[model samples]
Target: MKALRVEKPNNISVVEIPKVRLEKDNEILIKVKAAGICGSDISIYSGQSPVATYPRILGHEVTGIVEEISKSVTKFKVGDHVIIKQTESCNNCYACKHGRDNVCVDLKVRGVNIDGGYCEYITVPETSAYKIPKDLDFKTAVLIEPFTIAFQACSRGRLQKDDTLLVYGAGALGATVIQVAKSFGCKIIAVDIEEEKLIQAKNLGATYAINGKSPTLKEEIQAASENYGPTICIDSVCNPKSFEFLVDIVGNAGRVVLMGFDTRVSEIPQFKITARELDIIGSRLQHDKFEKVIDLFARDIIQPKDMISHVFHFEDIEKAFDVIASKQFRKIVLTF
Candidate 1:
C-alpha cells in the first residue's frame, strides 16, 4: 500500500506503508481514485494548523470506490463509487438532531482527527460513505466535500433571491460560494488578489469580479452594487484586514460570513459590527446536505469542473501539495 504521510509539521512523504485494516464492523475500505488538496491541507502541511498527530494522512477532499464492506455495513457494497464526508457527526448529538451537525459535540473530522484519503485506500465509517452517481468522474466526486462547505456556508447565511452578495477570495471554496450565490439570483461580487481567480469568478457567473489589489476596489464594489454596496458579504480569506474592507462594503444591516483559516490573533471591528447591525457568522464544514449537493453537481446545476484547475498523479502528491501552497492554482486534484 502507498500513502502520503505527514510525519511532522512541514514534512510529508509518499511511500509504501502498511495497508489499513478494517477492524471495525461498521467501517468499509475504499480504494481512493482521486483526492483534492484543500486550503486547510496546506495549513497542515506547513506548521500553521496542527493535526491530531504526527505521521497522519492529511487529505479530506476524497472520492473513491468501495473495495470491501464490512458485514455490518448494509448501506454500501463492494465496487460502489462513493464520496466520503470530511467529518463524521455522531447522530445522537444535540446539533445533529437539530440539523446543524457540522458542530456536533462529538464530531470527528477525517485528515485531522483521523487518517484520510491521501492514499491508495482508506477505511471510513459507513455513515460517511455516500454513493455518488456512476457517471460522475472521480475528480468531480472528490469535489463534493469542499463544495459542501460552500453549500453549508450559504445555508447558514440564509441567502435570499435578488439580494446582492460579495465573496472575498476567489479560491476554490470562494468560487463555490460565488456560484451558489448566483443560483439564488443574488448579484455576485467576487474579490481576490489574483487576476486569474477573479477572471474565473466572472467566467463561472459572478455578476462582478474585482481584484482585491485593484486601486479602486471600494469604488468598484460600490459601482457594481448601484451605489448601495452588497448586503451580504462572505470573507473566505478570514483575515481581519479583509474583514475591515468587508465591513466598509456591506450595507447597513448586512451579513458577513467568515469561512477561512487564519491562526493568528487579529482584532475585529466590534464597534462597526454593533453599530452597523451586521450579522457576523463563522461557518465550518458540511452538515446533512451531502445528498442535495451531490445531486446539484450530478444535474449539471453547479459545475465543479470549472474550479478544478490542476490535476496531479498520485505519485506526484508532493508537487500537488506544493502547487496548492503556491496559491497559483485554483483546485488541484490528485488522481490515483
Candidate 2:
C-alpha cells in the first residue's frame, strides 16, 4: 500500500508499506478517498505540534469507502461511504467511564498518537466509523470531522436557544460553530481581523461580524448582544491573550470554552473569575459528535461545501501546504 508519512520533523515522503487488513471481528477496512489538511497537520510537518509523534501517517479529517468488513460488522458493509472518528480510548479510564472519553487518560488519537488515514487503506473498529450519505462528495464529507470539533465545543459550552455566542476567529471552525450554534437558535457574534472572513461568518448565520481590530470592539459586542453581553464565548483563536479577552468580555455567569494547547503563562485575574462566576471549560478533540454532524449533513441543515476553499490531489500534498503558507484559502481538502 502507498502511504504518506513524515520520517521526521521537516521531512516527509510517500512510501510503500504493507497493506492493512481487518484483524478484529468488529473491524472494517477503509479505502481512503479524501482527507482534509488541518492546522495540526501543518504543525506536525513543521515540527511544531507538541502531541504528534515522528514517522506518523498524517490525516485526521477523513472520509473513505468501506471496501471490506468483517461478518460481525452489522452496521456497515463494503462500498459504504463513511466518516471515522480519529480517537480510540480505553473503556476503563476515569474519563471514558464518565462519558468524557475524548480526554481519556490513555487516549490514542489518529495522526497524533498513532497511524492515521494518509494512505490507500486503513482499518478501524466498526463503532468508530459512521456511514455518510452515499452520494455525498468526499471533499465535503471530510468536513464532518471539523464539524464534530465545533459541535463538541458547543456541547461543552452548554449553549442554549436564548444564549448569545461570541466566537473569536472567523475561519473554518469559527464559521462552523456559528452554524452549529445557529441550529440551536443561538445568536452569534463573529470576530476576526480579516474583513473577508467576517463577511463569510455573516453568511454562515452569525448575527453580527465585528472587526477584531475595531477600536470599540467591546462596545460593538455589547451592542450586538443587546447590551447583555454574550452568554457564551469560544476562543477558537486559541491564545493566552484571546483567552483573557474572552474572560473579560463574556456576560456574567457566561460559559467560556478554551480551544488551544498553548503552554504560555497567561495572567488571569482571579477577581473576574470569582465575580462573574463564569464556567471555564477545556474542550479537546470530540466526544461522540460524529453522529450528530453526520445527521446534520445528511439532513442538509449545514453545508460542508461552504467550509472548503481548496482541493488538491493526494500526490500534491507539498503543493497544498505551500498554498496554506501563502494564505490564500479557508480550508484545503486532499483527494485520493
Candidate 3:
C-alpha cells in the first residue's frame, strides 16, 4: 500500500510500505477515500508538534469504505461508508472510567502517536468507524471530524442559544465552530486577521466578522456582542497571550474555550478569574461527537462542501502543503 509518510521534519513523500491488515478481531480494514490535512500535520512536517512522532503517516480526519471486517465486528460490515473516530485510549484509565476518554491518561491519536489513514488501505477497530450517509461524498465526510472538534468545544463551553458567542480565528476549525454555534441559535462574532476569511465566516453563519488586526478590535467586539462582552469565547488561534485577551473581553461568569496546544505561560490575573467566576476550558481532539457530527452532515443540516478550499490527489500532497503557505485555504483534502 502507498502511505504518505513524513520521513523527518521537512521531508515527506509517497512511500510504499507493507499494507496494513486487521490485527485484531474487532478491527475493520478501511479503503481510505479522503483525508483532511490538519494544521497538526503541517506542525509534524515542520517538526513543531510536540506530541508528533516522525516517520508517521499523516492524516486523522478521514473518510473511507469498509473493504473487510473481522468476524467479531458487528457495528459495521463490508462496503459500509464510514467516517473515522481517530481517538485511542486505555479504557481502564481514570479519565476513561469517568467517561472522559478524550483526555485518557495514555491517549494516542492516530497519525500522531500512531500511523493514520493517509494510505490506500488502513485497518482500525470497528469502534472507530461510524457509518456516514451513503449520499455524502468522501470529501465532505472528512469535514465531519473537524466538526466534532467544534461540537466538543461547544459542549465544554456550555454554549446556549441566548448567549453571545465570540470566536477567534475564522479558519477551518473556527468556521466549524461558527456553523455549530449557529445551530445553537447563538449570536456569533467571528474574528480573524484576514478579510476574506471573515467574509467566509459570515457566509457560514457568523452574525458579524471582525478583523483581528483592526485597531478597534475590542470596541468592535463589544458592539457585536451587545456591549456586554461575549458570554462564551472560543479561541482557535491558540497564541501564547490568547488567554489574557479572551479573559479581558468575556463577560462575568462566562466560559472561554482554548483549543490550541501552545505551551507558553499566560499571565491571566487570579483576581480577574475569581471576580468574574470564569471558566477556562481546554478542548482537545473530541469526545463522543462523531455520531452527532455524522447526523448533522447526513441530514444536510450543515453545509460541509463550503468548508473545502481545495482538493488534491493523494500523491500531490506536497502541492497541498504549498497552498497552506498562502494562508488562504479553509479545509484541504487529499483524495485517494
Candidate 4:
C-alpha cells in the first residue's frame, strides 16, 4: 500500500507501506477512493495541530469502498460505498455516558492521532463508517465530515430563522454557514479578509459579504443590520481577538460561536458580553448528525462541490501540501 506519512513537523513523504488489516472484530477495511486536504491537514504538516501524533498518516475527510467487514460488523458488508467518521472516543468514558462523545476522555483522530485515509486503504471501526448514496461521486462524499462540523456548530447556537447571523472567515466552513443560515431563512453577514472568498460567500447565499480589509466593514455590517447588530456571530477563524470583534458586532442578548482553531490568548470585551447577557459557545465536531449531512448531500440541499477548486494526485501529495500551506485554494481534493 502507498501512503502519505508525516514523520515530523515540516516533513512529509509518500512511501510504500504495509497495508492495514482490521485489528478488532468490530473493525472494517476500506479501499481509499478520494480524500480531501483540509485546513487542519496544513496545521498538522506545519506542526500546528495540537493533538497530532508523529509518524501518522494525515487525512480524515475521506470516502472509500468497503473491501472487508469483520464478522461482528452487521450494518455493512463487502463492496459498500462509505464515507468515514474520523472521531474516536472511549464509549465507556464519562463524557460518552453523558452523550458528549466529542469530548471523550480518550479521543483519537484519523490522520492525526491515528493512521488516516491518505493511503491506498485504511482499517477503521465499523461504528465510524456511514454508507453514502450509490450515485454520489467519491469526491463529494468526502465533504460530509466537515459539513457535519458546520451543522454541529450551527445547531449548538440554536440558529433561528428570526435572527440575524454574522460569520467570519470565507473558507469552506464560512461559505457553508452562509448557505446553512439561509436555509433557516436567517439573514447573514459574511466577513473575510479575502475579497474572492467574500464573493464566494455572496454567491453561496450570504445576504451581506464584508471584506474585513475594507475600512467600511463595521459600517457595512451595521448598515446591513438596519442600525442594529447581528443576533448571532460565528468566528470560523478562531482567532480570539477576531472573535472579540464578532462578539462586539452582535446585538444585546445575541449569541457568539467560535468555530475556528486559534491558539493565541487575547483580550476579549468581557464587560460587553456581561452587560448584554450574550451567550458564548465553543462547538466541537460532528455529533450524531453524520448521516444527516450525507442525506443533505444526497438530496442536493448543500452542494460542497462548488467549494472544490483544486485536485491533486497521489504522486503529487507534497505539491498538495505546498498549496495547502500557502493557503491558496478554497478546498483541495486528493485522488488515490
lDDT for every model? 0.83, 0.90, 0.90, 0.85
Candidate 2 wrongly placed segments (more than 4 Å): none
* Tens digit per residue, CA lDDT, model 1, 1-336: 998888888888887989888989999999999998877777777767753666678789899999998889999988999999888788897899998777888877778777788999899889888999999999978888877888788877778886788888987678888877776787898999989888889988888888888899899999999988888888888877877778777988888888866667666758888888989888888777689788888878788776688999978876876776676787788898
- lDDT (10s digit) by residue, model 4, range 166-229: 8888777887777667777889898899888888888888888888888888888989988789
Q: What TM-score fits each model?
A: 0.89, 0.97, 0.95, 0.93
**Of the candidates shown, which would achieve the greatest TM-score relative to the real structure?**
2
Which stretches of model 3 miss by more than 4 angstroms? 326-328
Q: Write the per-residue lDDT of candidate 2 for residues 1-336, one digit (tens) a residue.
A: 988899998888888999998899999999999999888888998899998888999999889999999879899978999988989999998899999999998889999879988898989999888999988998899998988999999999999999999999987678888888888988899999999999989988998999999999999999999888899999999898999999989999999999899999777988999998999999998998998988888888898786688888888888987898898887899888
Q: What local lDDT does model 3 show for residue 163?
A: 92
lDDT of 3 by residue, 17-95 (tens): 9988888999999999999998888899899989998789989999989999999999997889998888789999889
Shift of residue 205 alpha carbon in model 4, Å: 0.8
RMSD of 2: 1.2
Q: Which stretches of model 4 miss by more than 4 angstroms?
A: 214-216, 325-327
Candidate 2: C-alpha lDDT = 0.90
lDDT of 3: 0.90
The positional error of residue 53 in candidate 3, measured at the CA in angstroms, is 1.1
| Residue-level error in angstroms, candidate 4, position 117 | 1.0
For model 1 the TM-score comes to 0.89
Tally clashing residue pairs in candidate 4. 0
TM-score rank order: 2, 3, 4, 1
Could you tell me how far off, in angstroms, the CA of residue 295 lies in candidate 4 after the best superposition? Answer: 1.4
